[model samples]
Target chain A: MSALPEVEIRIGGIDVGVEHDALLASTPGAGACVLFTGAVRGEGGLGALEALELEHYPGMAEESIASVVAEARTRWSVGAVRVIHRVGRLLPGELIVLVGVASAHRAEAFAAAEFVMDYLKTRAPIWKKEIGSGAERWIECRERDADAAARWIGQHTPTGESA
Target chain B: MLKLRFFASIREKLGQGSLDVRAAPDVVDVASLVRHLDAGPMPGCAATLLADNSLVAINRQLASPSTSVEDGDEIAFYPPVTGG
Candidate 1:
């Protein structure tokens, strides 16, 4: 097997397809590759939004995500994990983050990708603000997000010990 | 000197990313330090760091109210994250 990076984490905006290609390259031997992308959308009262602004702790945000990825690695027999997050003003329909996982099986890839994203939403030191016509407000963290992340607390692989 | 940082709504409410505070000797833990910073009604000056919803990190690690801190430590206070 050729040497390839196990983790590909970047804290900036980039072309999603290109990053996905890189992830695909890193997962040469994996049987399953799952990738998830998040994009800004105007929902509910945000329909009139002009843009969504993101802010993050310079060094802390990246490290926080890496820590979560490491946990996913310890739990699943995954081959690769790729994550990229964007910071700054992003218009509606612009991508915000991407998570990809490659593993020997479909279950592992799907779970790890979901795991990383679930943790990132509530744990990463990044924040979002909605901007509209002459108005701006910080996006509040949703209770459902915390629940989503928390539900995985005691979950484990079928053949592995509890995580 | 210990570096105190703020982010998101807290940074906006506090009006700065970082603060220069030569932490007092009496300040031993995060809770006390947060109290020290929640000084007044002035924007960009005093922050309600002790609020229940406020989150903290010490040297980039998620920290709690009881997290011990010293002069050289880096402490940050921010709101619950909203990143995906």
Candidate 2:
């Protein structure tokens, strides 16, 4: 059985410099690497976003990501997984978060990377406060996120399985 | 007794980040502890976060309502995480 890979979790605004290094180092033994970065957009369907604040349940947040990475390890021949998320005020076009996975093949790497992201969106304890033109409000969980996570329920699937 | 910590928005809303509670032996469970804390001097924001949902962890493990708590254990409460 492949042992669990190194998992790093950092809470900060996204930095390409940091992310690139992590991705490069984690890719050494892996045949494929998948990196995903999520950015804050001007609009989130709520309205025009002026700024956004993200809050997280600190201890639980870290533990949850660790568990997700561990679970991915069990299901695939993964090499390393790094998850970094920024908390605090963010502006449009700014990077919000990143997930990088390394595995023996593109299939495992890509699937595990996407799986970690899907679970993180729904299961992790993070909240968003959107500052928009009308008023600032706590962002509600989207039904889309629930649906995204739901698709992974029982099957050993890949990205192509969904959109 | 256990040390309970709050972080991020929960900490900001509560006005303070950490607290200590003397846990009665019979009340050494997460649900009981949450009930006790809820009845304490937690601020409105902190209280609101727990009104319907809040994440709980016992010693760095995602804890359920039935999770056990013991002396010196660290219990934390906070809002849902949105981090990647």
Candidate 3:
């Protein structure tokens, strides 16, 4: 049988740039890889946000993410999954989160990456507070996020099966 | 004893990270747990802190109101996750 899927979870800020090369070198024979990076925005959506303060349940946050990655593995033939979510104070335009998935095919890699991100947004035990212009407010989950995760609920019957 | 933990905005508002209280007869599930907390020191907490958007987890797993709770379980309440 193939080796167990690789999973990594980081809770603090670290150099995520090196993770790409690391995943490629570690996972031999993988044909496709997908990487998604989320960054903080300075303006627009949540007002003139200067920085984001992310808070998470110390133990539950990591556990929740691990479970999300595990679920992705069951639905797709993923090889290595690395997720890093930065907590504490994060300035605008800073890297907030990274999701990398490697697989033998592009379809599985792409689908799995999206699936992991969708679940992470809704299910993870992390929250964000926007700070800027003498105002600070906690951000709430968007309806679209729940809808995104809901789309994958009944579609887990396998690749070729009716979804 | 049942543990009630709060995070993010709810934690900030509640002014504490967690509280341990004996699980009374009515505190057998998340729904009942909310009721117990609501009637305590933090009045209107169930309405504000446990709003419709609040997320609940039992034993570190995401759970719903119907999920059963027992002694020694950790119940965490927080706002919707915004992490990517």
In model 1, residue pairs whose N, Cα or C atoms come closer than 3 Å (at least 3 residues apart or on different chains), thus clashing, are none
Candidate that beats the other on lDDT, 2 or 3, i.e. the better one: 3
* Candidate number that wins on lDDT, 1 or 3: 3
lDDT tens per residue, model 1, B4-78:
888989887777788878778667999777666565223334346767898889999988999999888999989
Q: Candidate 2 residues A21-115, lDDT tens each?
A: 56656566656678888888899656888988877666566677778878877777677677877777889998777888866678887888888
lDDT of candidate 2 at residue A86, scale 0 to 100: 73
- Regions of model 3 farther than 4 Å from truth: A1-11, A44-46, A156-163
- Of 1 and 3, the candidate ahead on TM-score is 1
Model 2 segments more than 4 A misplaced: A1-31, A157-163, B7-16, B38-50
Q: What is the interface RMSD of each candidate, in Å?
A: 0.6, 2.9, 0.9
Identify the leading candidate in terms of TM-score.
Answer: 1
Q: DockQ of each candidate's interface versus the true one?
A: 0.86, 0.44, 0.79
TM-score, per-candidate, Cα-based: 0.88, 0.76, 0.86
Alpha-carbon DockQ of candidate 3: 0.79
- For model 1, the interface Cα RMSD in angstroms equals 0.6
